[model samples]
Target: MSGGVDSAVAAARAVEAGHEVVGVHLALSRAGGTLRTGSRGCCTIEDAMDARRVADRLGIPFYVWDFSERFRDDVIEDFVSEYRAGRTPNPCMRCNERIKFAALLERALELGFDAVCTGHYAILRDGENGLELHRSSEEAKDQSYVLGVLTADQLAHCLFPLGETPSKALVRAEAEARGLAVASKPDSYDICFIPDGDTRGWLAEKVGTAPGEIVDRSGAVVGSHDGAHAFTVGQRKGLRLGVPAPDGKPRFVLEVRPVSNTVVVGPREALAIAELAGARFTWAGTAPDAPHEEFACDVQVRAHADPVPAVAVVRDGELVIRPDEPLHGVAPGQTAVVYAGTRVLGQCTIDRTVSAVPAAV
Candidate 1:
């Protein structure tokens, strides 16, 4: 349980299904006194206490497993290294892939547990081929994009009871009916480790900032910044450029080149991406029968963004995708989740992109 309404309700459903269920709360941070600041952070000491209460009410075993060291080495360090390399990474994806599923699930099976169930809003169905991962009935709460890293073996031992639920309001109501204390608790949002949600400030402390030049498409210096790591693709509000665009239009961050300590700004249209490919890829259940042949699929670049029609293929040991329409503001280190209708196909860490607009010669 996560000390939230969704997880509490999931635990209740699992118990009602007549299976021996145990509530396990992961302690991702070593700071035992860390507490949630409103709904901004999660998995704190307070959340553990709330989870224990729910387990007690359900008359099941509860334990707080310390995965802090592994989390720091995998998720936190990876976040810093990616930013240092001028890439924007999804920490939640890494947490789910490395810490939650890999580390936690491994321990659960060793302890004679059948599966590691959670409150994630996704579905698992027994397809003709094997186990298939699909989106949840609740469109607004669908989280299959983040779970695309799970392999065939992992999905076989997983259970998500809330996949068919129509809405989150119904989950909250069920929790209240069960007398769970966290029925009305606010859902956690931003990154868990960064409680204040100031990623730039936190990154600055880890990777010391240095003054850098901001340039345009034609190699013309436009402005200066304290650090190139502080900016991301498509950001436009805080440029503070000394020179304005020739047409009096606003310029957006197009790229961050950490090697030269430079930030590139340009017209918004330059952000359109024509093609993307990555070597680091994984399939959700099974690899395509003809991996080298092009296949139709929908690609999602962000967690909540709508998927776009695309053609994908595995070539030269990398997964390459070309969207029907140009993708805007996509950056390296971001995950591209491929899907066939509601079923998740796989995902890749975008290593590079080809801009739709040609550079000025």
Candidate 2:
């Protein structure tokens, strides 16, 4: 339940629906700490206790499953590897893909459970093609972007009780009405492992600092940074570049070249991306049947970001998306979620990009 109001309300709704539900709280961290350092992260011991209390209130069996080892191997290591490869990854997506849906769901099904229920704010509906994933009624809290990596089989055995909840405030109100203590628990914002939200500091400890040069488009060294892994595409702040552009305008990080140990900075215009190519594509329901080579769709690159109008095609085992308008700061390792209206088609892990700017003539 994550010891949050949303999940508590979801459990209540499930109970009210007359389904036999059991609460399972995953212990994601191996550390023996009970206190949360900040108001972020979901694996604190206090969170487990809160979840247990809710399960007690609901009069359902509760169990804390130790998934720490798998989580580290799958989510944590993948985060480090992606950064080392100079790609910006969304670890939350990885957690949802590898740990929650794949690992936990498999175990649940083996234990004779029909479906795995969670507090995610997305809807599962029976579409013409069978099962389909859709955005939550609460637009601001929509999490379909992260859950887009789920395949059709995974969606078939999943449930989201709060998908139709009007808003987060209503969820909290429902928890209060049910006398759940977690109704006022603050939502987690930072990455679960990096509770303090010091991503650069945490990465530096793991990836180590390899001093590198920060260069501009002309290959002129503009500044230096502790490591290329510390920066991301389209980043403007923290460059520590004392020199300004020739026109006295600011510059942004256009790329992170880990092999060269270089952070490429340039005019913001250089960050514009025309196309993205991704591997490891997965469809939520059925694959789209395009009469032609390409079809129109909406592509979302980041969580809670607006989906852009685009043309998509599958080529040689990869998904390619061409935005009708140029996008900026699209990084490798980020997910490209495809959608038709509000229905989530599928997602791909971006591996390459095509810049909008033409090469020097």
TM-score of each: 0.98, 0.98
In candidate 1 the C-alpha lDDT for residue 88 amounts to 92
Give lDDT: candidate 2, residue 211.
88
Error of 2 at 134 (Å): 0.7
Candidate 2 regions with alpha-carbon error over 4 angstroms: 359-361
User: Cα miss at 247, model 2 (Å)?
Assistant: 1.2
- Full-model lDDT, candidate 2: 0.90
Model 1 lowest lDDT segment of ten:
1-10
User: Model 1: residues >4 Å from true position, as ranges?
Assistant: none
Q: Could you give the C-alpha RMSD of every candidate to the true structure, in order shown?
A: 1.0, 1.3
Clashing pairs in 1: none
Model 1, CA-based lDDT? 0.93
Give the clash count for model 2. 0
Which candidate ranks first by lDDT, i.e. highest?
1
